[model samples]
Target chain A: MRNRLKELRAERGWSQQDLAERLEVSRQSVNAIETGKYDPSLPLAFRIAEVFAMRIEEIFLKG
Target chain B: MAAYNLAFRRYIRRFVPLTIAYGASVALATAVIPDGAPASPGIIAIAVLPGLAVVGWLWAMARLLVELDDEYLRMLEVRKFLVATGTTLALTSIWGILELFTPAMPKLPVFFVFPLWCLGLAVGAVFNRLRFGAARCA
Candidate 1:
């Protein structure tokens, strides 16, 4: 999966730490997901979307 | 800051007591039984009590992992445990095969598996640090 997590986080002036705090995960997790080294589970994906007030499809796309 | 949850704290607390008890039981069994002699069924049962504690520790570890809400820490833990499992299985199987052909090799009991697995986890923690920058886990 590919995601616009970094771009979205940047647009919101949120550092990876800021996003991670909101997601209740470590900054490394945000980094992993952003760099495409890790893919969030469905529940986590939903949480991410909720944090950004966007749809999951807007943030993540299937390759 | 890297932090552990209440469940993790409880897990560690539970581990300490169980480990002390396990050590005591193993020590008592070894001291009371004769060396190189087969023990009675009752004595064997007493000696294996520490083995049950080892299984309990694994269960606690699993429960701690499940209770964690942090994704990255959880990922690190899952990777570490998988690496540990692979290392233990590989080393033990190799040793078992070698013992069959090499008369000089010492025999390994099945009870030693958990200790080997624990050693593997230590090795896996080092691997995690190299791969992920830090070995943070609950």
Candidate 2:
């Protein structure tokens, strides 16, 4: 999966740690997701969507 | 998170004491039971202590898996265990076959399986580092 996590986080001026804190995950997890090394689970994708106030599809795209 | 930290701390607490117990039990068993000593009840009890300590270690690991909240970290841990299991099984199978065929091969002790599994955990950690760019979950 491809995600706009980095771009969205950048637009909101949120560091990876900030987003990780908000998501209750490690900063490494956020970095992994951003770099496409790991794909978030459905629940985590929803949580990420909720954090960004966007739908899951908007944040994550099919690769 | 506090939960992950708490789980990790609990794992450490259990692991340390279990390790000490394992060592002490092994030393005591070695000293008390001389080579080729017949298995009495007392000797059997002493011999079982180290195995029990290894069980405690397994229990501690299972508890950590259950208590860990971070899904990704939990997944990584599960993967490590899977890798360790596979490695241990494969090596044991190969060694067993070699021992069967080669008369010069030394008989592999069953107790060494636990240590081999532990080594496999280290191998798994290296695998995680190569695949996920982190050796330790924390």
Candidate 3:
């Protein structure tokens, strides 16, 4: 579950903490997603896409 | 959606330390009590009550932890509680059975049981949290 979360976050000058707040998750969760150590649930993935105004496929790459 | 939700951060900050504190207090109490001592109903009550309080605290904390909007987080917490309950029951049953078979295996003082129980609960929480949070570094 690779994602463009980091890239998008960086573009907005948002730290993982910033992204996690928006997603209503712990910062660690955000870090986990960025590092691919955790795969976000579908709704969370959708939320991320929604935040970035992109399609889910554009943010997440299935392995 | 926007980026760190205050509620989630507050949840973690509040509960993680509570779990750790409960565990440390229980462990300390367990270690302080002598294993061989006279047992009585009163002593057992003393040993069990504080541990029971810690459980209550953990339960209360769990409620707060799940107050956020993440269903996944809520699910993980519920699973942790279930695991803790099952493990505690199994451990207690085994200890009781063991006592019936051999009374000489360093009979833990009745007064110490509460602290030990609390300690067990605390340790259980720590393990659950670690398992859940470990991937954060990955």
Q: Which candidate tops lDDT?
A: 2
Question: Model 2, which residues run further than 4 Å from truth?
Answer: none
How does model 2 score on DockQ? 0.63
lDDT of each: 0.84, 0.89, 0.66
- First chain of candidate 3, TM-score: 0.94
Which 10-residue window of candidate 2 chain B scores lowest in summed lDDT? B129-138
**Which regions in candidate 3 have their CA more than 4 angstroms from the true location?**
B1-59, B70-83, B108-117, B121-138
Model 2 agreement with the true structure over B1-138: per-residue lDDT tens digits = 456678888889999999999999999998899999889998999999999999999999999999888777787888889899999999999999999999999999998999999888888888888999965642
lDDT of 3 at B115: 47
The TM-scores of chain A alone, one per candidate, are: 0.97, 0.98, 0.94
- Per-residue lDDT tens digits for candidate 1, residues B54-102, read 8788888888787767766777788889999999999999999989999
Clash count in backbone of candidate 3: 6
RMSD of each: 2.7, 1.2, 6.5
Best-to-worst lDDT order: 2, 1, 3
- Candidate 1 Cα errors over 4 Å, as ranges: A61-63, B1-4
Best-fitting candidate, scored by DockQ: 2
Best by TM-score: 2
Higher-lDDT candidate among 1 and 3?
A: 1
